[model samples]
Target: MTTTTTARPRHDAPAQRARRGSTARRETWGSAALLLLPAVALLLVLRIIPTFAALSEAVPLGSERSPWSNFAYIFSDPSFWNAVRVTLIFSIIVNPLQIALALALAVLLTKRIPAVGLWRTLILLPIAVPQAVSAIIWLVLLRPDGPLNGIATSLGLPTVPWLTDPTWALASIIIVCSWVGVGYWMTFLVTGIKEIPLSLYEASALDGAGSWRQFWSITLPGLRRPLLFVLVADTVSNFLVFAPVRILTRGGPQGGTDLLMYNISERAYTLGDTQAASAATLVLVLIVVAVVTVQFRLLPGRED
Candidate 1:
């Protein structure tokens, strides 16, 4: 004889399922937080701590000076003002010039040219060269009696003072920086150019759009994010340029090339003004921040 047995529901209740999902999410978040803890701790130790320390030391607690004496000293110093001017001039001149040149070079390299790979490699050769070495090479070429002037004299052209004259010294530095920088910036832009869908360009071409029109319509719009990144990074790099100034110019030619970074270094090392130098660094950070903020507003934002 068999007795009828009552059947139990095989599925969990909605509340039970919800509780299980909640528990799973909590565990996942806990594990993720645990994994991120070390990285966050390292960042705090390496960056945040040093930054706060510098800021605090800039206006330290002492009878030696007022609270903002360090900042005031730097702000009032003519040398610091000259550094600001030189740095601003360098950034304004070089950033656009470098980006424009890089874009042109990227387009050229992307075109169908014989031995294009070799040309790209040669252009990128400077990336492998140390900045100091590059600066020294340029220094040798630009020296008064160097090969450049010698060649100019042989050609019956007047010898131009490449590095000695204040008028041309900063421009010389810009040329050196641009030569070294364009290839590196082009690599980024070329990668961006490659990422655009070929169909877009093909369709534009089929529609009778010229290269200039297509560049403005398709290429520029497609490259908004990359261009913004390049602009910001290049701006920061130009503002912080120090090695070439240090190696080749040494901020000389009547202080025509005294960039902010070099000035800070000189103050910190030569004059032993760490506090004032820290103030200068903070000022530089503020300038860069302001510039980047403006750029973000002006440039097209990320893809929606």
Candidate 2:
């Protein structure tokens, strides 16, 4: 009887303490969710809603009102396919080339070259200039009577139609795009390179590895994650390229530089065909998704 009485004396104490702890955790989480709601709501309204709306417009149902006809229209048009091809070609050429050049430049900058800070600044200067402005500047530079042609003429070479000629129009677009983008992309590579542990390089040197060998054996392997990140980011950015095309080429010299984004913009704004534009956007999104999915799948241990 005495033992039972003693044990019953403090039964409410444990329950009370547990209730207080639970209440404290609930308040903490409630405050955190309240703080996060605004950002979550903004993203939903701006990004998620518009994406779904665009998808809806792309899908033509029946009586030509369905998304099927819209998709059919996009797929059936030879011009659309041409634009797609051009876009893919542009992305494939520019992204890899820029990445290679950027990596090279970043490595050079990292090597304590003379006036290194100055050189880095000069390389990044183009990024500070607006893309539209850069395109316009290059438009003048590449013109028949401009600096490039002048230089060629001084060297006893024939003047070339850099922008107007169909043969050179796409190439010019790619060059201009790379010029504007390479510096920006280089910054990312530089950051990734700087993050590598110095000990790895020292160890590689101790193993009698030359600079090139060290880069291949240690640097490249260390950069796998950053390289993947940059690759995906650059791919997406290159796929959406429109500024240079819009300002300098306008998808011209017989649409040689017509990218998918330019086509969508033309349909939506110039042609006032929102539905068609939305369909084009949906198609572009699908292509991007497919590319990214394939990339991640091929990457080791990336599934998680």
Candidate 3:
């Protein structure tokens, strides 16, 4: 009698639920696509299209020399090699210097310090000024007769040739790049640091961990993703450095500051060798991709 009283199942319930879920998923995907359309379109137009155009221009066509001639020419040129060397050296020095300074400032500013906002504003102020304007300003500052040398003279210190001597010219470019980049990188680190839970620090203190120990264990691990991002972005930015080199050095006191981008621009604009410039562009892109790939592999926390 009890078994006989058992009602038949509502067979359509599960199907109805499935239909509802499918509809919801479709709506969610549609919304996401709508949200992403503008950015995707912009990237396609600005970046993807131009990169393909450059690639087409890079390859030699009918009635031209060998398909690899442009690349061969650049590879054979001493100036191109010098630009590569200078770019590598600049990257080796500037990336670490900027990240270290930015991390230090991030840590210091995130502490309970008075007038921290004012300090941050002052640091970030340089980013608001255009890089070209910044180059012009530093052009004046680094000149032999400018205020920097005037101060050095007042202090009885040797007046340095910041932008004229080859070694000093590269160093001056590094300085300018770092001054602009450090604050920008610091903002990212500061945001990362704030996202770290206060409970972790408190727990570490309770466990008798010193400031340095806490930083090593907690802060650095928290910063892995942010640091990786900064590393890649900073590397790319440094590689594409052209304005400062063009404005300040014009590829050098002995080609010392001729970064790859400046070299490419010089080939295209100055010498009217668009083919060589396009080939160099491909090389620059490849180098950036390789460097960034290595950075991603080395840094932990990809899951984040």
Per-prediction TM-score to the true structure, in the order listed: 0.87, 0.84, 0.90
Candidate 2 worst ten-residue window by lDDT? 1-10
lDDT minimum window of 10 residues, candidate 1: 1-10
Over 4 Å off in model 3, which ranges? 1-32
Candidate 1 per-residue C-alpha lDDT over 191-256 given as tens digits, one digit per residue, 9 for 90 to 100 = 899999999999999999999999899988888888898998899888888899998888988999
By lDDT, the candidates rank as 3, 1, 2
- Give the higher-TM-score candidate: 1 or 2: 1
Compared with the true structure, the alpha-carbon lDDT of candidate 3 equals 0.90
Candidate 3 per-residue lDDT, tens place, 1-304, comes to 1123235446658877687668767777887898899999999999999988888888867845888898999999999999989999999999999999999999999999899989988997888999999999999999999999999999999999998899999999999988888999999999999999999999999999999998899999988888888888888888899888989999889999999999999899989999999999999899889998888889855784
Worst 10 residues of 3 by lDDT: 1-10
TM-score of 2: 0.84
Best by TM-score: 3
How well does candidate 1 score on lDDT at residue 137?
A: 93
